[model samples]
Target: MTTILLLASLATLGYAAWYLILCSVSPWERCRRCHGARSHRTAIGTRRDCPRCDGTGIRVRIGRRLLDYIRTEYRAGSQ
Candidate 1:
């Protein structure tokens, strides 16, 4: 009983840490390949938008959509 509960708590905490490492509520990291330029030079001597960043030069983390939803709900409740 007590032992089981302790194991469960530790498991939960481990899972939470793993989740945080695997995901992020906010992603502000710039695209390394494009260096935030949103465009790069091609082998053909032509410039093209970065495919990895979809020309945005920024990537959204997995949990950002959830954070946006929560923020919207909080704002609605506050108002």
Candidate 2:
């Protein structure tokens, strides 16, 4: 039981570290809706910019957004 708990905790820690590094290195990821094409095709074959990413083809990672929010909150609290 203890071994399983230790392993789970270690896995969680490793994933967190990896995600932090990822957010630091590449905070943006391809938009799921546009698949990095920046636009989507309508049923009639017309193309429109992706609404989610605003045609940027990428969006900020959730982890990075969370980090930014936390940093902003900390700064506001400190001041």
Candidate 3:
């Protein structure tokens, strides 16, 4: 039925939003915890191509944009 389809679509959308939130923690944040361990990869986030590393995944992101996006989602979720 159309009603059932609508509910399923809504559920899928909710799950996608949740997945994005869970993957916003980039590896750069972890480096702050342990000295000389900046090579760690993000456990839940993506590591896209970096010009400096030539896709070797050793480069750092310019800013903490991932954390910013996560904070925005958190605020929306709380409201």
lDDT of 3 by residue, 20-64 (tens): 565454534232322233333456774434333444434343344
Model 2 off-target regions past 4 Å?
Answer: none
Local lDDT at 57 for model 3:
39
Of candidates 3 and 1, the better by lDDT: 1
Model 1 TM: 0.45
Q: State residue 18's C-alpha deviation in candidate 2, in Å.
A: 1.0
TM-score of each model, paired residue for residue: 0.45, 0.93, 0.32
Best by TM-score: 2
Q: Which candidate is the best by lDDT?
A: 2
Candidate 3, which ten residues in sequence have the lowest lDDT sum?
A: 29-38
Steric overlap count per candidate: 0, 0, 0
Weakest ten-residue segment in model 1 by summed lDDT: 19-28
